[model samples]
Target: MAEQIELHEQAPRLKSVSSPQDQDKGTSQQDDVDDTGITEASLTLEEQTDLDARRGQGFEAYPDGGVAAWLQVLYCFCIMFTTLGGVYSWGIFQDALHAEQLAPSSTLAFIGSTQATLEGLCAIPISALVARFGNKNVAVVGAILSGLGPILASWCTKSVAGLFVTEGFMFGAGQALCFFCAATLPSSYFSRRRNFATGLVYAGSGVGGAALSLAANGLIKSIGLPWTFRILGILFLAINLPCAYLLKPRPIISPIHHGAQGGLTWGPVVKISLLKDIRFVLVLIGSAVALFPLFVPPFFLPLFATSIGLSSGAASSLLAGFNLASATGRIGWGVMADRWFGSLNSLLLCLAANATSTLVIWPIAGRVGPLAVFAVINGFCAGGFFSLIPGVVSSLFSDDDLPVAFSMIVSLWAPGDFLGAPIAGYLLQAFGGPDSGYEAYRPAIFYAGGLGVFSALMVFGARVKEGGSWRRRL
Candidate 1:
């Protein structure tokens, strides 16, 4: 039911004046807070008009910064810690599967790639489910699948195909459900501090990844892989089930926020007209291309360390350190996005830095000292991608259009995430099998780095489309 409230006897009208540059770009700056008490700097003239029309309609205002909002952030952090944090720790399992000779390197890469791909691809349908069923209900399903998949996978360790179904498809599906629901909510909860809040949310992945990677290594050594998975399953259930219960989506009139009463209808799944916008198209392409090289390092870094004669424990430690640095990067980038460089600008800078580090550092880092340095720099740079994307999408679209726009951006990440590491694995095998020297890995590194460069260029193009001035905080 819509809340009924009395309006002030003499309600003040919010106003904004467009500058010449804003006129050229077609965006308006809200000089005064809206009825919701939020100042939206990126609102288009049409969006501003829509909000004005909604005033005095008895809609609840955005809490923006309150206990309820921060609690949601905390819940989202725990969700990411279990979902993507586990995915980021795939290097530990990759090394183990390789040792067991369970499958070819390319095939082994698929197990990780499949889960990662599904996380991206499944977001489209999950968004619909969230719209109809509500965030909490959908998140409950996610928690179940995420916990159940690994538990079942423990029984299917002998067959590579079995791992695909349990670990890859099932776990991937769960991640999509939980991750997308949590990721999309921050935009609704906060406007001024959205970037910073989102940064803190995503930083969970790095922290979880770092912690779980170390834990998995110890568990694998102490008991075994199967037992380690069972323990992880119990942990996922305990953490996520409670978080799912606490998911209190802000009451909104939009279809996606309709929860159970929304009736099987999807409001704006993709907004087909957005395909025609050059800015949207450019950012979409860049987002897709960026992932082409994103997983290459995380998937192979442990193997690379071992190839250079580091002990297994030492190699795993490097990955853990890398993830810790990634956590720092997420927070740092988020602050930068909110305080200094705007989201789009931050994304472009991060991608460029990510590509540079991969190209210049990895190939020459044959020893422990250099490899450790590469991990920290590259991990921090790569971490920015997760923290900045939502802000960039929000900047380009209206609040009503956010669900569809952000869905499209994440959905496109599937192709690159699915294929990047497998291609690298295939290249490694083609050049020479495991018996071959580290030279076998060079082609894969170059391929990943080259794609990173291309992704940065595409983002640069998007930045140009937005207005190429470096002085402007895009």
Candidate 2:
């Protein structure tokens, strides 16, 4: 009987020891939950928490001063300068083309309008493609096309129609490539300092535009338009080479079995999310309306200068000043947005200042000094609009959704971009051209300023609805 009792007690002890092994096996099974891939659902609680923390930090993914990151930035700067510079220098080319080859102010305006429209419109498809194939590959293709377009244009028959095909269609296509590459790459690098990085990249556009305008204007005066275009094409090619080598996306491992197969698919998820987001919709509309007037001044500023008695070289220089000021403004405003204030708050302030500067300052800028000041102020204020937009959009959605959101906004803005410059041109002709003394452009400034004010009010309304004060946030 004692032997039987001892045996029973020993059995209980053995079972207790075996229980821990069973528990460990269960844990091992749980750990295998993500063996297939990395998906949102597969992430551990800790991983999700870490992701949220990173998101809150804003554009912090990029390694500060790392060779790869800085090289990407450098490439972005070149791309920005070439594409944006070309856009900013529209006035110089428009003035020259209108006078020499493509005569009639209204006709020449189509070139700028078409280029801007294409640049914006192309982003929709390009963004998706980049998401699928990766930015480095897409950017290289874009750079080649952009760099070669001008060279091809230089060989075209020099008539309005020919110029339209070469300069408008070809060159515009190139610009679109450069623009997409620059804007998209930075989105991949930094999450916390995104605005600051983006601002710096975009500032290169103004710098490129200013520097190129000065160079192009001087070259055009000395060697004429054909050789000038050829030289610009060479410069574009040189600047684009490094961008092709450097700009790349962050490595993201997918969890779904075929997730990497189709790249980023456009599905109900994208549609539903975008449609449900009222803030995004309003911001997109505001972006379109705001961008409309921004291009008008740069498009016609050189012509306006000539109309007011400045020489061709002097007029071109003013255009350069406008771009130079714009570059400075972008960097300065970006810093303020990233460091001092929230992106949304900075946007509102910029819109208000842009409106005030345009209406209050530009109307009286018939004289040289005042015009210069107005250009600088307008450029500076306008910088905030471009710099803060992506960050503000980012605040509304997660990283995975960013490419689609950005694409949608760009697609929506295409029509407005195409129409803006042409409308300005018609308005200019209606009021008067250089012969009529720029009276038409004066009214145009007021219209642009009014739009800026209206946009600010919309943003303010959104802020109020969100129960936040703009000043407090800033």
Candidate 3:
């Protein structure tokens, strides 16, 4: 009776688009836990309403495996391919910049770090905009900025400071908005196959990195760096805009938990109360720490390869191999998460293994063979961090809170992402820079592995908190 009354009251704000039969079917579907093992029953009544309203019809079931649903995955692939794909291939640019003696390795690293940092830093407001104006609108704006930033950066390639604003700040902001949408929207479309679908979406980064790494290297060889930036800017605009447009998410109304924004209220766009939840807090911290090591190898692999006597072309191939391995791991880990291990459990294993690969495999890998092995191992395990996080976030929150919750969680990643590569660069520079030989890179490698270990421990705690025992699938 209370639910019915609440539904009536909500009618003005959330008009039901489904017929009575459709609503009844949706209600039944909502009552049961899905294959991902998440249930609406666990949510508060308000949260439940918010979830229902977000479905557009206030009760529509997920499309699951329909054309519309799969197309979203494809769209997200393109977005990540053009945006994060390029971000992952930052080594190509860094290598070129290093050759030119533009600045210290640390300073050059800061350019990429700035872009990575903003991916987390700007997420809160962008997510709030997602909640308020809808996902498509925010993503469209991101598409524009994603392109514009690079186009602008082409003119500023001569100045590191200018690159900071264009490539670092602007590009990072655009990636954040686009990534949030890509990462979160597929969950709205899938229940049983949520992990797998998200894995497919994130795999775009690996595939894009693999392809674009080679492409960027080739472009740089053929044309000058400035022209390369111009071509990439045009590429970003052409691809990201269409994908952003075609990527339709379920309609999201004002989130009551955050309170509706009125005339210029200056609080966090999505005021998350999840901070009070210890499990969420732990997961948040773990995810942030995980970021500390996630990009280190990608950013430095080419330089590291060069130190070990590989040519520039070979270094590019190694980076591409790492990305390709990561792509495979994204899909493979997602399947494992769905079939055998739970998302949290899978994430725990991945982080631990990722750390082990970095700590154990990397230090001993002085030759091409060992280094190549480490790259593959590290890339595969590292991919799990990106793939399973959506599933983990989905497990913790109701659908209505997902966009904000995920954004808020990742926003904390700004510090880790911002510092990870720069710290590595500084470590290398402190030990005598990249010219100081392969031994100079160990400190940074240890730093990255240590952060991964810390992240794994945090994840373990969160998992224990969730299931009360390590034996459970949760």
Candidate 4:
């Protein structure tokens, strides 16, 4: 039964029906506040549309399983196929650098790290930039830059520094641009299936790494490195170009407020104070902390395998188990979130499983059978760590506030992504048996497990904070 309260006068403010955790903080303000903390205004005869006019189009109703919607998912996969293909395939390029002889191993390693770091760091600006310029505009420039970066890198085969700028900085920036374009749009298209859609989108990276690795291996052999890069450069644009054309933001209405025109300003995009939202703040801390160690396995697994007495070939082959399992985990976890677990719970499950695998299985994975098993377990559980992100973040905000919530939450991953593996590496070097390749990685393994421990605990805290108790599912 629904009842209406009769007001003597029209209220100028909008009431927020926000999460349980926020009610206390929300009450502190005398004025009604939107989820993002902006106060509502009295309707003006000068020219004002009401709340209905302010809703973004797609979230009100998802297209669900339309051909057009599914096509966008496919397009996201293509973007991942190319962008993360490059990200994951950095090892191939790192190996090929020996032929160029322009830089030492330490110097060459920077090239890949720089590309990755830039990709992560630039995401904050790119997410907000999408509000100003449409997804297609940003994505097209990304496609152009992605293709041009490597094409230009091909010309500078003799100069490591030139490759650094072209392949590292330019390529990474382009990936960031194209990446957020695909990543941010999917949430608006499917509410019930948002996790499933996002899962497929992120699973693109794993799929890309597998596909591109084989292609890169063969391409480098048949055509040679420079030509291979040129071919890949061409391929990058070919894939992203169509995808960018199709990517679009849901129609939005930014309501007009006092003393200004009705348009998004640089102000909202640049605001970090939004971190003041407790829900947003906890999510940021939890995500960054989880990712700080969550990223270790992909970077160190093969190397760790070799240290355990496995042949280099066998160690490399083991990576397939992790990658395939990751793709499966992503889709599976997304389904779980849509069905039963919900975002925070599903994420907690993943982090717990990942941490357990790292501590118990990975430490003893030196044996061939144990190594394969650990790889499978880690990949399956840890894969959802990224896939579940859209769910958790989406739960924190209403449709109106989704853009800022998404941008701010995801921005945390940049620093975590860049720093995780390096921190793990330092631990290995410091604690591993002296001169024993990966034998002394015990301390590093513990470090990874420790990160997982804290990550899981922190998210549990956030989930409880959101829902107010264990009796509720978040």
Colliding pairs, model 4: 432-440, 433-440
lDDT of each: 0.78, 0.68, 0.78, 0.72
Report the number of clashing residue pairs per model: 0, 11, 0, 2
List the candidate numbers ranked by lDDT, top first: 3, 1, 4, 2
Using lDDT as the yardstick, the better of models 3 and 4 is: 3
Across 1-474, the per-residue lDDT of candidate 4 in tens digits comes to 001111101122343322323454764435445334455444454323543343222114566678877888888878977886687777777767765677775577777777766755775677667766778888899988888898898888778889989998899888888887887567766778888888898888877776776788788889888898899999998988988888865443111122233333453543465566676677678778887776688778777887777886786677766777887888889998888877788898899989999999888776889889988888888779888876786776555455566666666777777778788878877775325765688888888898888888888777777765554445
Compared with the true structure, the alpha-carbon lDDT of candidate 3 equals 0.78
Q: What lDDT is reached at residue 366 by model 4? A: 62
List ranges where model 2 is wrong by over 4 Å.
1-65, 251-270, 469-474
Candidate 2: what lDDT? Answer: 0.68
Per TM-score, what order, best first? 4, 3, 1, 2
Q: Candidate 4: which stretches are off by over 4 Å? A: 1-60, 99-101, 252-264, 270-274, 432-438, 468-473
Better of 2 and 3 by TM-score: 3
- Evaluated at residue 245, the lDDT of candidate 2 is 61
Q: Which stretch of 10 consecutive residues in model 4 shows the poorest summed lDDT?
A: 1-10
TM-score of each predicted structure versus truth: 0.84, 0.82, 0.84, 0.85
Q: Provide the lowest-lDDT 10-residue window in model 3.
A: 1-10
